[model samples]
Target: MSEIPVTPLLDTVDTPSDLRKLDQSQLRQLADELRAEMISAVGTTGGHLGSGLGVVELTTAIHYVFDTPRDRVIWDVGHQAYPHKILTGRRSRIRTLRQGGGLSGFTKRSESEYDPFGAAHSSTSISAALGFAVANKIAGKPGKAIAVIGDGAMSAGMAYEAMNNAEQAGNRLIVILNDNDMSIAPPVGGLSSYLARIVSSREFLSIRELARKLARKLPKALHSAARKTDSFARGMAMGGTLFEELGFYYVGPIDGHDLEHLIPVLENVRDAAEGPCLIHVVTTKGKGYGPAEESADKYHGVQKFDVITGAQAKAPPGPPSYTSVFAKALIAEGERDPTICAITAAMPGGTGVDSFGAAFPDRSFDVGIAEQHAVTFAAGLAAQGMRPFCAIYSTFLQRAYDQVVHDVAIQNLPVRFAIDRAGLVGADGATHAGSFDVTYLASLPNFVVMAAADEAELVNMVHTCAMHDSGPIAVRYPRGNGTGVALPEVPELLEIGKGRIVRQGKKVAILSLGTRLAEALKAADILDAKGLSTTVADLRFAKPLDVELIRKLLISHEVAVTVEEASIGGLGAHVLTMASDEGLIDGGLKLRTLRLPDVFQDHDKPELQYKEAGLDAESIVETVLKALRMNSVGVVEEVRA
Candidate 1:
């Protein structure tokens, strides 16, 4: 093992309780050490760097001031909880973040009592914290719920919804709006401690009480006038607040980097609030580190990088990634059709819409973190006879299911759904995995759900969606690189409900959907080697269900199998339903479906996750051999061995 760097101040602290024991004056040094330690940990095991760095001082302040584990400190998105994890007795295993059997990248209730709510999806912290606050109020428990949410995360409607209902949660709720995007956390040239002390001082409250008492003695007309003047003055002075309208007492846009301001402000909010309070702490996204500070988004989610230079380790160059393929393909189609447009929900870069946005800036819309609005907005564009490709990660697309069902699918609009990250995404675990999109979308009427087998197929799918103006269509693809297949000079539009056979044989048939076609072919090769004639078919559309092609495969072959990178009730389920309805199962025909397990899986390498789910080449072979009751080379043993 490499030598761990000496962190004297950080090493002295094991938990938030230990942090509380230190004097107020020593907190700045502690926060400094904490930031260094968090950077070091993330450098070792790459995860969210900028967010965690941005909140180092705030995390330290919250822990130092609040009685956590009892008083729930719910972190929104948990992207900024690396420092919180280090101070909460998970320091020893912090280096194993996002790895198999390691500490999770996000907060989890199972991981620690301190993490009262588990979160990876944004805009959920305020709602979860409100729940804790209300539950504590009912139980008469001493639990204060503090939700530390980023300003970017506040774009989601759920945050505003929670804030609207916050009064019911009583005064035990605190929301620290980490406004890091605006680069507002500037250093206070020595007056920080004095200003913070003045706010937290008892004289401030005495002045408030005295003013209220003096106001009560004034005549009714004068009192009303004074109250109006005070509200107006406060609004003018504080610039007003939407959260205040929602019943929260608005506080500063203070320097989050300043420990003097953070400690006293947090102390004041902890004691003074009899209703929900929102403290807008403005900080830089990537604070302290020169590289991270210089390039905020680049360091937001980094891989293993050089600590000194901040140069991330790049993956070996290969075929173009699925995301790039979709982007380029969409760009080509958009070049041909002026009506084509792109939309994303706070993930312009992640969904590969950045290039499209550049090419057609007028047509591309990045609806910041608002999935529901993105879906309905795309539907509106489609209704106006425009080809709107709403590109969203499958996991995030789930958030707009109601809109998809009601506004798009039900209305039968021509909205094209470019569903990226359509399978288990490594290092993000089950919450971020795109497992259920097929089930949800396939079940919807008038929705055509298709998945690409490789880069070439993805191009065709993009063109197909662009040309087809019948109803809503979805094209799902995996996260990483595609098979090194040669690109077609020009993409051809695929038939709506189609399955193309890559290999033709007899005895057994392996039907695949999405990127699992390669694995199905590999399984077919194994079956052929075992003296069993096998066929491989790429069932492109999960929803349309190529009934005729499926019947041909089922009738021609004694054994049939459906392989998909989706959960139950997807392609396989649809096939089974089609086959059963057609009475194809009455004969001695064997059928099987291979899919992701029902349980939520933890983060690991993509290959390992596929292997674990029994969706890999070897697993396909094993499943086929087991279904046939053939002891040819003992499939499972040979693969496992």
Candidate 2:
């Protein structure tokens, strides 16, 4: 383990209640100590570093100023809530971040009461906080709901939608916009700090309330003009016209790192008898740590590292990540065709659209944290002569399901959906897992769904998607580096709805989809060693099942198993449905489907997750053996080597 940082003040505080016991003057030391402890903890555990570091003082201030648990505080996208977690009595498990049976990478309600509303996806805090505040109000409870949301999260429409309906929450709802990336206003300084403090003060709000009452007694025209003037003055001084329009009493552009500035303003907002308020707090992404401050993205998500040198552990050199291969393949396709374009929902780097954007700036679009818009935009592009590839994570693509169904699938538009993270993502846990894309996309009409078994297959699929113009098509691939297979120099445009047989055998047939093909091959080898000739088929397309091939395999093989790195309703379900439709199950053929379990899987190593899901080689072999034992055909007599 790395040397743990000394945090004298932080050691005294087991929870936010203990934190509130200290004198106001001692908070600076507490904040400093808290920041150091967080850095140390994240250094050991290797989770989200930059985001959590950015909100140290803000976390401290919110806990100090507000009565938490009673006054619920929800952190948007919760990746930045590590410091919040530390303050809220999870410090002991802080080092176990993102590990199996450990602290989750994001906020989880089951983890603590401090996390009133759990979140992993962006732009959901405001809406959730509004729900809490409204529920409390209905119950006649004395509590506030504070939402600390990043400015980047504000790019999504859901945040604004919640803000628009926040008037009913009254003084119970508070939104602190943590502006780390987008500088929506001038830099925070003495003037901005003074303005934030003054505007959020009780006296100022009282005076404004009196003026509003006075204006109500005036003529309709005068009252309207008075309201406009008040809005204009605030808009000019603080640049909160947009938020003001959304029915929030906007405050700040305050320095989030400054404990003194944040505490008083937050206290004022807490006590203010107004409708829902929006406070814009500006802070650096990597606020305090030297290494993180210097290179934000590198330290954003890291591996266990040397704390002193800020050197992260590096994985051994291996094959390129599936994301990179897809990017390169997309770029190659773009070079061949001018109409080919790309779109991503604020995850350019994660989805490999960053490389595409760099290669063809005009043809690529980073549509912010708006997956719905990205899908529809791609649909629009496809409706025209241009072919648009909407590259999004499987988890996030859920946000645009309505658009996928209504706009793309229904219209039969030729939008290519490059779905990344299509299976269990180890550290990110259940919320970030891509376990349902195959099921969801395959179920849609006018949609062709495919999954890549390896890097070369991914290249071919990308080429296939590029050339495909029949309707909405998607290719799903898992996270992390590919299986070290040599990538094709020239990508092949695979035939739609077709699968290839990898090995030929007689008794047992393994139907594999996505990255589970390697495990299927291993299972086949194990079965072959046991004198059971096993056939391994990489059924690339989850939808449009290769009827002839599947029927032939089922009729020829005594036992057939379908495996996928997805949920129960995906490839397995589809294969079962096809078998039933074709009356292939009546011939005394034993069949089984291996997929992710019905329950939501927790954060763990991908291999362990797959094993637990019974999608690993050993699990596959066990499943096949179990199936054979249950068979009445006496296959045990033919098992001799």
Candidate 3:
């Protein structure tokens, strides 16, 4: 790792309060060092790179001006918190970020004194900051509360709702609208354009000042009417008059990158602001870095890379990732079927739909971060006799749970969900883990949930969902590269609710779900060498489980084990429920469920996390042997292939 040049101003500053002591010129130099440190650290750790780099100056300015420990600053979506973390007494631990037992990638309340409110999901900062502001008021403590939210985050309905409530409350709050013109992808919908128009309007200030002066000089009774007229005039000229109507004192269109502009604007707002104010600060997404500025979205989050070349370190060549496999399968399916279409919520590239979008531009839709709209939009398309595949991350899909239940499931819409990142996602931590989708979707009516055990199975599942026209179907796959299994030339759809027994044995049976099949196979081999033959079955569908196969296994085997990569309420829980409902446990067959525990697992390498959770080959072997009441076998004992 290349050593970051330690500047005198940055060296003494261990926390935000320490940063407050530095002069503006020194702070500017510190900002440069912070950016360099962030780029270098992320180049080594491989995390959300560009967002943090963009916010280096903003973060430094905020910490310098604000009271910090007393004055709460909430960051929306938390992706831009790397610099904040580094400045807030975590400089030494910067390299350990997103690693297991290390500093989290996002704003974590437990990690530092300065991070008063933790956030990962978008459009939540305003609401959280308002809550803190209200509490401060109640406590009779005079303190400033600021919410630094992105233009992309402003699209969510929750942000509007919070703004409405904050306006009604008339609390002293500052909302910094970070107008970066992009989220993970280029922002979508009418709001994005409206914001752009309002921010870019050159004549807003001169007109607003004249109107305000005229309103203030009006008679007391006519003041309200004059203010309304001023608002109407502004509305006709600029689009953000809707925000003015919401009762906030709207300010800015200031240059967020220019320190001279930002410093004075922020100071003025801080000194004179009484009610909730929205400062629209325009900033470049990837401000400092040349390559990042050129391709902001591509550099939003990156793997370990060369700082000079901006090229990611070469990874070992292997089988295609599950995401790539799904994308290819969907594209092939779409080519075969004219009605088939694909949709993603601002994540076409992340979801591997870039290829699909290229092949069928008209058929593909990038809906932005509005997950609620994306699900219902897919439903609307499905209602019109179109086969819509809503490709979304499992973590992000949780945002549209209500929509999924109401619009898709209750109506029984044929929307195929290609749920990527359906397991422990390393580095991004708990906020991005694909842990709860299985549990949430399984409980919903008319929802068919399936997990892929490998790349081939994922392809098969995608093909199956595309072919099925009955109801809503979801096929979830994990992050990272797949098992090195050769894919079938022609994709084949498997029978719905039918599971295949991969390995047959005499005494005990292990029923696996998702991509943990290989681990189960390894466990079975380990057991077989110890004179305990184990049967392994891959339960394909979680919703309409193969009861007959399960019953047969329960009757034939003395012990049954259910394994999955999901949380407590997932595949294992469903199996236990089925056993209870069928009264299968009356036969005295011991059942053990192995899945992710209730507590949130820290960010670690997927294999390491699996081993830690006792879901790896060795752990699975140990679990099975212990369940069978067998002695610990020697590690050197080899099983016949």
> Once superposed on the true structure, which residue ranges of model 3 sit more than 4 Å away at CA?
169-171, 182-225, 232-239, 634-641
For residues 41-151, could you state the per-residue lDDT of candidate 1 as single tens digits?
A: 788788999999999889999999999889999999999999999999999999999999999999998999889999999999999999999999999999799999994
- Assess the local accuracy of residue 585 in candidate 1 as a C-alpha lDDT between 0 and 100: 83
Q: Could you give candidate 2's per-residue lDDT for residues 161-253 as a string of tens digits?
A: 999999999999999999988558667798899899999999999999999999999999999999999999999999899999989999988
RMSD in angstroms between candidate 1 and the native structure over all alpha carbons: 3.0
Query: In model 1, where is the ten-residue run with the lowest total lDDT?
Result: 183-192
Q: How good is model 3 by TM-score?
A: 0.92
Q: 2 or 3: which has the higher TM-score?
A: 2
What is each predicted model's overall lDDT from 0 to 1?
0.88, 0.92, 0.83
Who is ahead in lDDT, 1 or 2? Answer: 2
The TM-score between candidate 1 and the true structure equals 0.95
Best by TM-score: 2
Models sorted by lDDT, best on top: 2, 1, 3
Taking all chains together, the TM-score of candidate 2 against the true structure is: 0.98
> How many residue-pair clashes does candidate 2 contain?
0
The best candidate in terms of lDDT:
2
TM-score of every model versus the real structure:
0.95, 0.98, 0.92
